[model samples]
Target: MSDPLLDVENLRVSFATRTGIIEAVRGISFTLGRERLGIVGESGSGKSMTGRAILRLIRPPGRVEADHITMHGEDILAASEARMRQLRGGRVSMIMQDPKFSLNPVMTVGQQLIDSLRAHEKLARSECRQRAIAMLDEVAIRDPERVMGLYPHEVSGGMGQRIMIAMMLLPGPEILIADEPTSALDVSVQLQVLDIMDQLVKNRGMGLIFISHDLNLVAKFCDRIAVMYAGRIVECCKASELHKAQHPYTLGLLNAVPDLEHPRPRLEVLQRDPAWREALSVSARS
Candidate 1:
């Protein structure tokens, strides 16, 4: 394999609290190529924080310190605000958990997407409108022309999510960080949404950082899985081999997930140990 598309070494994020300094994301390192990488953990386990740090989206009071965050050999951590703005939706984009929260209610879906397109490149208004409609159609949204005229509230949750995907992908970003994109959608729509994302990732050959708490979903979708505990990754392995993870934390998480085919009397509760956070190790499995 060649060098990674994105590389991270000793990335950390912390916040200043009244009591003391709180380290939300400890020293964690990983690299991403043109493939899917899943960061799976419970809430407050820092999976979402890791994604935010990658994009430099962590705001004030919450600090982001990284030894290096290189994207295609350029240091993103050191990039100026202007350069960061250009890179944000143009070079690397993120699809948030819910479209309702991420999309602007005031703007029509078409206008929002057109704004993104125009931000990244110069084009005629008609051209941008055409491209926006085309992008919506690509996400499996029927009647895209009508959709282009409708407000965010007029669309269903699934449609809203697809519109957001269309907007984020219109720029043809090199890397995508999806933070539990399908969590808020219906079970039927979940697979539909995932299929759209998977197809787009494959078609674009983009590096994907999929952040989710669902071990089973990530295992099924990602090539590599990084299991995170409190503020750090405890293990890294091939998604198919997650069931055979070596770390105690990984084992506990795997045991906690309910098996649908065969029901257990009681799901196992995860027992946390203080020593698990002492040293972070990357156990890469073939």
Candidate 2:
């Protein structure tokens, strides 16, 4: 009933390679309120690129053009660098796919977390450290003190993810873009991490954009699902309606997943159609 927290319209991104210009994300549109929205597709499907483009994190050699990208009532695509910096990690934060690559290897976990909080808020040293430790505890870290002093390399993958979650949540962002937040963890740990994220997002009433290749996980954790193929979204519907998806590509993806109840000799492979890609590009431009 209220205005969406985030709105993206006709978003496009492309990379200039030696061979040719490769379009990573075709013009796509979506909106998010205080609800979970899942974008699921295989690697190179432009899922991660879409998330990065929303934050305007694309670097040189890559170009991002959007008709509109707004947060609340502010125009993000038109914002100045200084304003964008203030928006990033303050009003909108992202939890990268790999904590090992994202975290500062040389710094202590507590130091990194404290720095993140201090970047957005003017707080005393003692207050920042206290808030950092409290956030770690909130993410279900058992021994916050020990974990805080330890370097990123010393902690397990699951622990690293929880720390990253704490850091992202510390700023109290209105929207969180989490790209495969639990892809590297074990099954048990994966569920635990997702549970922590789920609980925190709901508690804070923040809109979430969950990007992953796991259809089953998305169906369970998200309220709505967006199925991406090539560089565009082919189907967007409620998670429960995924089974009844009308698009051929969506159906193919669902059929490809393994069904435990009905054991099969082999999983079905996706059948690509160049025509589909061409049509999507045309539609994107229109």
Candidate 3:
């Protein structure tokens, strides 16, 4: 078989605090082909940090150490800044959790979209604008012309997310990392955004790393699921196999969610286990 599209190994990220070091990611490893992979865990499980580390977006006072990080045969961890720039957005794009922070408030949506296309491809102004508009339409946004002219703040949360998707798609990336892509929107709008993303990823044959805390959503959307706990992946299996997960942490997480069919007196709570932490440390070291 051919090599995976993206390969990560023994990836670790930590922040240096006054007290000591806070390990955000504890040597997790995974490989992605042209398929959807979901990273699920509660908040502070290092899901977002893992995604950010892959993109080399970790800020100062934080340290990232990895055994290997390769994308399509290229050594991403060793790439120069200029080369990394070419890879980021052009070959691998990320859609942030919130459009409010990702999009420029002052810039018109059209300008940002067009700029994204122009940065990757040398196209005529007319061609760029046309492609930008087409992308907006592809993401299920009607009246692309009017919406393109409006600033980010002028549009609804769902629309802004669609625009962000358009911009990310404009780059024709091989891998897309969506971190809590629909967390800021209503349930109705969230489904719409996810459907658009699902269609695009399928049509383009791109590998997707979907990071979310919603296990139910992950089970429905992803091919495989990785359950993270305390900065490490405690379980990795096919989405359908999640119910049979062997890890205690995974079982705890699965049990915590309420079951609609069987009404319960109270919701199940997660029980902390020190053995899980010890096992995680051993796994990281190994």
Candidate 4:
């Protein structure tokens, strides 16, 4: 088979604290192809850090170390800041958790989307506007022309998230790092956003890194699931087989989820194990 779209090895992220150095992402490794790969863990388990480190988004006082982070044979770590700028939205786009904080409060939706596209592509102003509206339509936004004139605050939460997705995809990136993209939306809106993302990824043949805390949601949406704990991935498996995961940490996570059909008196609490932190991260490269 051909090479994977992206490959990461021995990736670590750390921050300098007054006490000492604190590691957020402990030497985890994974690969992305033209498929959805889910990284599921509790908050502060380094899911977001891993995603940012891949794009070298972690700024100083914090450090990103990796043996290699390659995209199509080029090492992302070795790329210059200018090259990274070219890669960030042009080749790899990220949809942050909340659109409110991510979108510029001063800009209209149309300006942000058009600017994002212009940053990566040399298109005429008219062409950029047309593409932006078309992308909005692609994400199922009705009356794109009207929506474009509206600012971020004017749109509902669901529409804001959809606009963010549309803005990210306007660059035609080969990889998308979506960090809790639907966390802020209602359940129905979450499904709508996920369906939009799912269709887009399949249609564009892009690699997707879906970082989420919802284990059941990830299991349903992703092709494979990487169970992370204490900054390490303890288990990796096909999403369909997540129920059969062997790691104690993975089992604990699974047991903690509430099932509607099999209602239990109480959900199981995850008992933490110190050894899991010291264990090597499971590779999610298959």
Candidate 5:
């Protein structure tokens, strides 16, 4: 079989606080092919940190260490700042959790998208504007031209998120690491955004690392699911078989999801096992 588009091994992230080293992401590894791979877990499970570490976005006071992170055979961990810049948006783009925070408040949406496009490629202003509008339309934005002229604050949360998606896709990245891309949107808009991502990933054959805390949603959207807990991936399995996940944490997470059909008065609380922190394990059900 061919190699995966993104290969991560023994990835670790930690912060040097006044107290001591706080390991946010323990040694965990995974590979991404041209398919949708979901990282699902509760909050503070190192889901977003893993995604950011893959993109080399960790800031100072925070350290990211990895055995090796290879993107298309290039060692990402050793890439220069310039090379990392080229890879960041050109080869790997990320749609953050909230658009209001990611988008430039003072800049017009069109200008931001055009600037991003121009940053990666040399395109004329008129051509860039046209492409930006087209990209906005591709994300299901209504009246792309008008919306493009508006500022980030002028748009709704859902529209802003879509605009962010449009900007990210304009670079033609081979991989997209979306960290809770739809958590801020309403249910209707959430579905639309998810559909946009689903169609785009399938059509472009891009490798997707969807980072979210919603197990059921991830199971539905991704081809495979990686269950993270206490900074470690305890299980990796086909999304269809997530119900039969073996790890105690995975099982706990599954049971914690409130069921509408069965109408349970109270959902089961997730119990943490002491041994989870001592060892990192990856299941092979996928």
Candidate 6:
């Protein structure tokens, strides 16, 4: 890849609890070019935390440490809060797992979209509205003008996700961190949402960090795959080569998925090893 869009080294996220410090992410490193990089793991494997830590969204009591986190060669770990605010939704945008919690309940879809755009760029109200509608159309929302006036609750789960994608892409960010954006939708809608995101990312030449638990979905959508286990990346490989991943944890994850064509009598139960947790994380760069 010609000069990666984002780079990180030895990134770690931890929290202080009554028992002790619980590490959510431990010394994980990766690079993202203008291509899709998928992070897949079971729940509590730090897939979401890795995304949040990249954007410095982890709050107090949750400490993020790293050798470095850089975007376009600029050190993210050293950026100030104000700079980070500029980066979020401007240079970099994040789509949360659920729009129900991420979207402002009090605001209409139009209002939220306009506000998000205005936060990143100086534009007239009419222009912002026009741009917002155009973005909504781009994401394949039907009758975007009318849809804009509707509250988030009024839209279906799939439409809500498309709206979120439109809102995030409205600012023309170079990178997008999507955390399980289609988890709430039906299988059909999930594919539609993924198609929209894939098209947008390719059209914009943007680097995408796709965080999800679906191995099949990730394999189909991403250019590269990083299999995380116990808060660390156990295997990194080309998405097309994921089935051939060597790590036991990676093989376990693949085996855990049910195949309809070659139906198994019962889904294989994932057997965990204590050593996987203690093993060093594999670098996903390049």
TM-score of each: 0.97, 0.96, 0.96, 0.98, 0.97, 0.98
**In model 6, which runs have C-alpha deviations exceeding 4 angstroms?**
none
Candidate 3 wrongly placed segments (more than 4 Å): 281-286
Give one digit per residue, the lDDT tens place, for model 5 in 165-217. Answer: 89999989999999999888788998999999999999999999998888889
- CA lDDT of 50 in candidate 3? 89
- lDDT tens digits, residue span 46-161, model 1: 98898889889999899999889999999998999899999999989999998899989999888898999999999998999999999999999999999998999999999998
Candidate 6, residues 1-286, lDDT tens digits: the string is: 6799999899999999999999999999999999999999999999999999999999989999999998999999999999999999999999999998888888999999999999989999999999999999999999999999999889988999999999999999999999999999999999899999889888889999999999999999999999998889999999999878899988988888888899998888888889899999999987
| Candidate 1 colliding pairs | none
lDDT of 3 by residue, 243-276 (tens): 8888877787777777889878987777888877
Please state the error at residue 148 of candidate 5 in Å.
1.3
**Winner by TM-score between candidate 4 and candidate 1:** 4
Q: Which stretches of candidate 1 lie over 4 Å from their true place?
A: 283-286
- lDDT per residue as tens, model 4, 1-286: 1699999998999999999999999999989999999999999999999999999999999999989999999999999999999999999999999999999999999999999999989999999999999999999999999999998989999999999999999989999999999999999999999999999999999999999989999999999999888788889999999989999988888888888899989888888888888887888878
Cα lDDT, all candidates: 0.89, 0.89, 0.88, 0.93, 0.89, 0.93
Question: Clash pairs of candidate 4?
Answer: none
Number of backbone collisions per candidate = 0, 0, 0, 0, 0, 0
Query: Arrange candidates by lDDT, highest first: which order?
Result: 6, 4, 5, 2, 1, 3
lDDT of 4 at 153: 89
Worst 10 residues of 5 by lDDT: 277-286
**Model 2 segments beyond 4 Å from truth?**
280-286
lDDT of 2 at 54: 91
- Native-referenced Cα lDDT, model 2: 0.89
